[model samples]
Target chain A: MQQQVDIGEVVLHHAADAYSFGIDPYFLLEWHAWEFMQLGPFNLTPTKHVIFMVIAALLVFLTMRVAGQKLQQQRANENAPKGFANAVEAMVLFVRNDVAIANIGQDGAKFAPFIMTLFFFILYMNLMGLIPFGATATGNLGVTAGLAIMAFVVIEISGVVKLGPVGYMRTIFPSIPGLSGPGAVAMSLFMAPIELLGKMVKPFALCVRLFGNMTAGHFVILSMMGIIFLFGHLTFWNWAIGISVATLILGIMMLEIFVATLQAYVFALLTAVFIGLMQHEH
Target chain B: MLLALLQEAETHGPNSPFEPEFGLIFWTLAVFAVLYWVLQKYAWPAIVGATEERERKIARQLEEAERMNAESQAALDEHKRLLAGAKEDARALIGEAKTVAEKEREGLLAKTRQEQEQILERAKREIEAELGKAIAELRRGAVDLSLAAASRLIDANLDDAANRKLVVEYLDSLEHSR
Candidate 1:
């Protein structure tokens, strides 16, 4: 089905049933009420969701493989590292030492491989959206929220192990040390709901933040690009203006690329932080 | 709250505006597991192996450096030993030369003293011989003078050998006193 909308207004995304408009400044907010990929039986009915996930995974693997091959060739001298390998090495070290280790400490090292993988995986997926007909997997709340829940589960499990049963309860109730009186008890009681909210808020915020940043950047670039199509087939003014606009959009697109990578990094970083906080006293 | 939102999105149902999402949980799990497995197996090993190789190379370089340092130290010690031995040999040669010069100086001094003593002895002998010859000649001359005086004074013929002998003896005594 085809429909015509306003000329100046932006069309953020086009899906099967409905389309989205530009809103939520940070990320393009869109949802499909239906399942695109239907799972086939003995697999007769296949769903678009599964297809999308597989495609996302493959793209991630290929990009990283290209990067990994480049890394090895650079390391042959091993003493002298160069090019993409150097860039990748620098990123790995930063995430490993500066972000992961610094935030998560010794216990966090176990998750380093997975966290690094997640960052690269999300990063590649978000970048693919710039291509024609590609979807942003990270832009979906269901996807981001699901990933957040995994982080949540890991966080809870890690906290439980570190804090023990009584210690985990005490975390939810942080009364001032050496307070045993009724007033102290009351204050602890008052803080419980707020602490609970904060706990729930962590994953919600993570979902929104990743989804928003990735989708918003994509939407803006798409809208800016729509300017070229708006101009007619042949005219000198159209050429000048269209070229200039396209250049501006490309410049903005470069900024979006940086943001795409950074958002992935931040998501992983915050997940580490939340987990670490749970393991620690404060 | 869940039913209401699901219903509202569904109400626009015709070319059904909102289509229900089914078993996202199941496919999501499968894809995620496959992703985790593939990544763990294929991608990570390459990176990890390369990293280990780099580390090994660094370690080898360090070991080589240490070996070179030790070799240099041993060479330096050997060179120092050779230099000390050469210095000792030079000192020994200098001492031997000094002793030989001292012996030569003592021999030259002894030969000069012996030659000087011989020259003085010969001059003394020559002087004594000359003195003896001159004394004898003087005694002979005195005897001759005394005899001539006696003959001129007597003027007669009756003098004998005894008289002549006495005159000679007297002249010898006179020469000795003078």
Candidate 2:
């Protein structure tokens, strides 16, 4: 009996990233956030989320690299595409044709790599959460924020590069004809902050939407687990509740699979759209 | 003061799920950067390039097929035109042969008519010459017979004057009354 209780506690400890191990003192920062030993001055602590993120990244990289090689070879041999190479090529075409090019127009090819990387990275991260004993790195606010920051940087830089500095500034702060020095200055001052806030809001939406969606799915799955524990004490009701809970959890898991891919597509697509908006001045 | 407060917050726990951690964000950015770099270098270019190339090649092939189809259609039309012309030429050739045959038949008819006319004229001339020769011979024979009869009457023993007179009278009567 005591051994089962200990095992349950250990399982819960590993499941929640926000919680510490074994409910010892709940050392908030020290344990809640993953911590590891340092070499010299740099802290290189590999958290569960970070580890999964790396795995997802590696999975995406290796699969795509292999698929890329096969596709190139397929071209050289003039053979019909088949198998994993065929599947990955379809996805690559969809990302390029439907998502990237559809949103970004002619210059879409230039940003195809970045958008494809973002898409596959998020997709793998979302799918990783569904695996046994796997945690979703995208569920982490910090990670999503980081991704959003990267998108934001790309958006801003491409805007400047596509439209020269003056053109980009004019898009943000338009000049009105027949307005003298004072009025022009006043209008520019007024619109500049709003435009800046608008630019920041797009990435903020990307971050919160991805983080909230991923976290919600995980939270529901965890809550379902919690229900099983809540009914554990009542032996009579436990079995009945366990069956229902398991069914409900299975349904949510299926829904999460769809949500995961949808969220990843949304993130990448919106990033492309935002970048495209900046690429052309109205 | 802000740095000191951040240090203090670090010592404690995150205020909420919204709380951002330096290490997590830094690592996320670092990892994503590496992913982007690696993918940008190898995966993206190859995949996009291959897909575009395939699409372009397919379009080119389709265009070539369409052009070939059009050329074949033109060739078929030309063949049909040639066939129709050949049929027309055969019809004209048959008509020309019929006219030529008709002219030859007419010429043969006219030549046969002319030859019949020439043969009739020659037969008439040959019959006329043969009839004239027969009339001349018959006349000569009749005169010889008459002279012989006259000589026989005189030798039958009458006076020469009386016989001569009788014969002369008879000859004159035959001449007058005969």
Candidate 3:
């Protein structure tokens, strides 16, 4: 019973209203739908993660929209981009040149917009999580899975579109060149399911990797802070926990920031590669 | 109400970490799709197009600048070539003028020397003829004096006019026969 209570308290403290300093923005927002306007039949309540996701989405939209306008207005000039425009443009170019072109080849230009969208969107969502009041949407498995699903769809579609359905199937199951008749047939049949599962594994890895990294980092930070609460009665122990673990927590927070950026990059990079790999066999 | 719902969500399952909520997935997909569509439609093309256009423009400008530089260099080279040709032509003209001047000086010297020589020869011939005339005049004067003396010695008492006339006629006949 004590263990259960401790676990519950820790979960509530970490995942619920963190710090209780009113820094938890979720508590500030009203969750009740006025009258009969519930979201779904499954009693789906809009969580803080959803709100943060929307905020991230809006941020991406507004930035790109403004940058797009700036780009349009300055179309004729030969000067470099400046300020916020410059920053966004650098990221866009990075995704286009390094990520998209390097992976997708000549046909990469067609998908630059989509790849750019993915990179900036993921980057914004990741970075938002590091803020005081913000929660990482990507920390949620459902969100990461959704993102992975989108990437998976793009990869599969590009593969199917570039290589016909027959060719796409052949990508999964290859016939041995020298083997004739039943042997090659048996080999292909044997490899088909495995190859299909291999395709699914890419997105699954992306989902789990992002979710795990983000969740683990936040948990470590929360757990480190929980140490002070764990030894609240012992003043010396609380001071020691505060002094020692506080530094480590700060370091980990910095690391979390880095991981946020890195995971975003990884997600975007992998998405580009997956899409590119589908289009080109090599 | 929101806090109550959140508390409900927080306690729905202790293993909430592993739970994949359909609502969140649907919302994420919906939100991301909308964002992607808005960006792709209104933002990306413009941003990317402008950037590419700017890049191409810069490349073209660089190429233009390079081409202009090359053309200017060629022009300078041509100018240098023309100047060199002009310098060569001037040198040749100076050489030709020097040679012509040298020929003219030589011709003038030769002509002046020939004129001097002709003048000296004419002066020499005139001097010789004058000297010969003077000597002949002196000889004639001496012969006339000697003739008078001889005539005086031969016939002091004789008729002077008749004797001189005879002598003169005799000398003239002798000169004619000789």
* Candidate 2 lDDT over residue span A78-107, tens digit each: 987788988998997788778888999889
Error of 3 at B178 (Å): 88
* Residue A242 C-alpha lDDT in model 1: 80
lDDT of 1 by residue, A1-282 (tens): 214433222332232123332333555445443444435522212234345556878876765566667766765656566676667666765675566667887676666666766676677667766655555666655566667776777777778788897788777787767778997899888888898888888987887888778766765676666666665344667778687888988898789788888988898899888877887754
Interface RMSD of 1: 6.0
Q: Write down the RMSD of candidate 3 (Cα, Å).
A: 11.7
Winning model by TM-score: 3
Candidate 2 docking classification? incorrect
Compared with the true structure, all predictions reach lDDT values of 0.66, 0.79, 0.77
Q: Candidate 2: where are CA atoms >4 Å away?
A: A1-44, A176-184, B1-17, B54-178
The RMSD (Cα, Å) of candidate 1 is 13.0
User: For candidate 1, lDDT tens digit of each residue in B72-158?
Assistant: 999999999999999999999999999999999999889889888888888888888878877777666755666666766784463
Candidates in descending DockQ order: 3, 2, 1
True contacts kept of 3: 0.57
Per-residue error at A38 for model 1, in Å? 8.3
Cα error, residue B77 of model 3, in Å, equals 30
Q: Compute the interface RMSD for each candidate structure.
A: 6.0, 6.7, 5.6
Clashing pairs in 3: none
Model 2 native-contact share: 0.48
